[model samples]
Structures are given as structure tokens and as C-alpha cells.
Target: MDVVIKDRGNIKWTAIMLPEHVAAVKQEIINLEKVNQPLLDEDRLSEIEMLIYEAMEYNLQLEFKLFKKGYIESIIGSTHFIDYIKKEFRIKDKNELTHKIPFQKIVDVQKV
Candidate 1:
């Protein structure tokens, strides 16, 4: 006589998870998807700075890609305030909500 056995991995364990444990597992999955920040060359950094300067001087709308906490975030807005000493700038979005970002966090810049 022979017996057959089957293996159920993580799915079988999920049945015993409480609601809070399930939520925590979902959040862990999301955190696992986060990516490392991209490195920018000097030429690329110069280009981004030039674009930002033009946007601020000409009152043009610009889109900025930022690296924050291992995630890439996009912001569309016009440059509102720049603090040179602090090396950070503020942008006002379409909804007039201002967001302050640091120079080192900038990944890319484009005209809108």
C-alpha cells in the first residue's frame, strides 16, 4: 500500500493569518518592489540644472522625476521658491500644493 502526499507552501500558511498579519504581508510585498536609486552623470546633472533654470526664469511648467526612499516619484509643476544656501527648492503643483525637494534627490527634469 502507498500513500500520496501533496505540499502546499505559503498559501496553506495564509489560512492561519489574522487580518492584521495579512495586511502586514501585503505591505511587505509592496516594500519588496521598491528599487534602488539611479546614478546620474555630471552631464546629465548639468542638463537637469539648466532645464530647471529655464523653467524658473521663463515661467514654464516642468516635470521632475525624483528618487525618494528607494522609489521614483514624478511631480509636474512650476518652480516656486529656491533656497541656494539649503540646496533645496519648492514647486507649486496644479493644485497649488507646494512640495519641497532637495537637489540630490532629482533624477530627471523635462519641460511640460
Candidate 2:
């Protein structure tokens, strides 16, 4: 036997929200109003591509400042691949895990 109570009080709804529902709501908020990722222009994308390609060809370390989730984050790694068509920067982190990161909101680039 199971019993489910509803329509009890306004504040009680928070207790009923499942983890998946909460995550969805948070993602919606980020997509609609919270995040501040600026769109990178074509020129800037090309410049960044050059930097990534140079790093890839020379086995050099590169660092990038990316805008995401209402703030900027920096990642330092060697590029595994730059998917220009998909606009994803596939990089190998220190743990040797390759991550496909969104590169459309790059704020700064530096080679280390």
C-alpha cells in the first residue's frame, strides 16, 4: 500500500520536487536568464582556431578563458582536436581525460 498527499500547502511543493525536476529547473534558469556567455564573432573564432592549431602542431601548452554559467573559467591543457564544424574544443586535461568543450564564448587565449 502507498499513500501520496498533495494540495496541502504552497511551501510543501519544494519537498515534492525530485532531483531530476530540480536539475531541469536550474538548467532552464541558466538557459533563460542566468548565464552570460557572449557570442564569439567569426574573426575571433578564426584567431582562436589558429592558436589551437599552433598548439596542436607544436605540442605546446595552451590556456583558455571561457565564459560559461554566468562566469569565466580557465582551462590549461593540450588540445586533442579542434572540431571547427562542431565548434567544440577537444582537450586532454591533466588527468588525460579528453573533454569536448564548447568554444563559442572564449574570452581570452594564452599559450603557456
Candidate 3:
């Protein structure tokens, strides 16, 4: 999907995502939540929360790195993955450009 983030001048920046990447992030969050749920102590809960956030942050960073390295699409499926990309990449107006296109198609268009 394509998400559009606009600057002050209404200049839009688009973020592209694959369904698989989104799903993988969602699964990661679910797994973290599952791991965190068993802890009852406040300190442990806090630590788990922090860990979850860190994991998500790290995942987003890694995804961006992969994107830069030309791994444009993900092998998993989740919309939340795009949300992470939006936040990590400082994207805006995600609803504006959620279209699905082939990765190669986007790359080809970008070349123009």
C-alpha cells in the first residue's frame, strides 16, 4: 500500500508497504503481548512494555534498512506494519495512499 505524508507546503511523500511486512509486525506485537501477559509484577510489566516498544522500534528500523537495501516487500501479512513504517519514517496521511501495487511496478514508476 501507498501512504502519503504531507509537509507544510502540501508536498506529499509516499510510503509503500507490502502486506506481508504488515502481518509480520502484527504477529510480533501479538507475540510480545503474549509474552508480557504472564508477568504480574509491576516492574516486570513495565520492563515488558519497554521491551515491546524497543522490539517494535527495532523492527521498524530493520524494515527501513531492508527497504533501503532493496527488500521492498515483506513475506508476512499485517496492516500494522505500515503503521510502524509511518511512525518510524515520520509519515503522514496514511489513509491517503493505501493502494496495492506490485513492488516492481512502484519501482518502475519511481524511476520516471
Candidate 4:
């Protein structure tokens, strides 16, 4: 005759953890999943700026890749507002929702 054992994984430890401890462990896992923002070279930045200007001048829809809170996000829209003083620009998406994005957060831009 032989005996077998089973692994319960997180289910077993969760029962012994307090609510706060469980929450902290969950938060730590989320933090670990996050990534660092990428750095763009000057040439790439200039290209993105050019694309933004071309899209705005020709009234074309464009897609932008942005870095936010250690995550990469993609947005498709047309230029809405450009604030030179604040160094941030706004875009109006298909739903007519406007989003303000900073230049530093910009990763890549493309005409769509």
C-alpha cells in the first residue's frame, strides 16, 4: 500500500492570514507585476512630435502609445487641445471623450 499527499497552494495559507495581511500580499503581487517606463531617444521623440503635428494639421485619426503608472496604454483619437504652457495635450477619442496627456508619457505615435 502507498500514501499520497496533496498541495493546497494559496488556499491553505489564506486561511491563516488576517484580512490586512492578505490585502498586503495581494498589493505586493500587483506591484511586482508592474514594469518600468521605457526611455525614448531624441530621434524617436522628434518623429513622434512630427506625427502628432501631421495628424492634427490634416485632421487624421492617430494612435498613441503612452506610459502611465508603469504600464503601457494605447489610445486612438484626434488632437483636441494643445497647451504649450503646460506641456500637455488633449485628444478627443471616438466616443468624444477628451484625455489630457503629457509629453513625457508619450511612447510612440502613428497615423491610423
What is the lDDT of every predicted structure here? 0.91, 0.79, 0.33, 0.90
Q: Which is better, 3 or 4, measured by TM-score?
A: 4
* Regions more than 4 Å wrong, model 2: 1-35, 39-42
- Index of the highest-TM-score prediction: 4
Better of 2 and 4 by lDDT: 4
Clashing pairs in 1: none
Poorest lDDT segment (10 consecutive residues) of candidate 2: 5-14
Candidate 1, residues 10-112, lDDT tens digits: the string is 7898899998998999899999989888999999988988888889999999999999898999999999999999999899999999999998898888998
TM-score of each: 0.77, 0.58, 0.21, 0.83
TM-score of candidate 1 to 2 decimals: 0.77
Runs off by more than 4 Å, candidate 3: 1-39, 60-112
lDDT tens string, model 3, 1-112?
9998656431221134466866776777666644111214666446534543564565422121112232343222112223333332221122433333222222111100
What is model 3's C-alpha RMSD? Answer: 23.0
TM-score of 3: 0.21
Clashes by residue pair, model 3: 2-97, 20-76, 20-77, 22-78, 23-77, 23-78
Task: Give the residue spans of candidate 4 off by over 4 A.
Answer: 1-6
Candidate 3 Cα lDDT to native? 0.33
Clashing pairs in 4: none
- Measured with C-alpha atoms, the lDDT of residue 31 in candidate 3 is 60
The 10 consecutive residues of candidate 4 with the worst lDDT sum are: 47-56
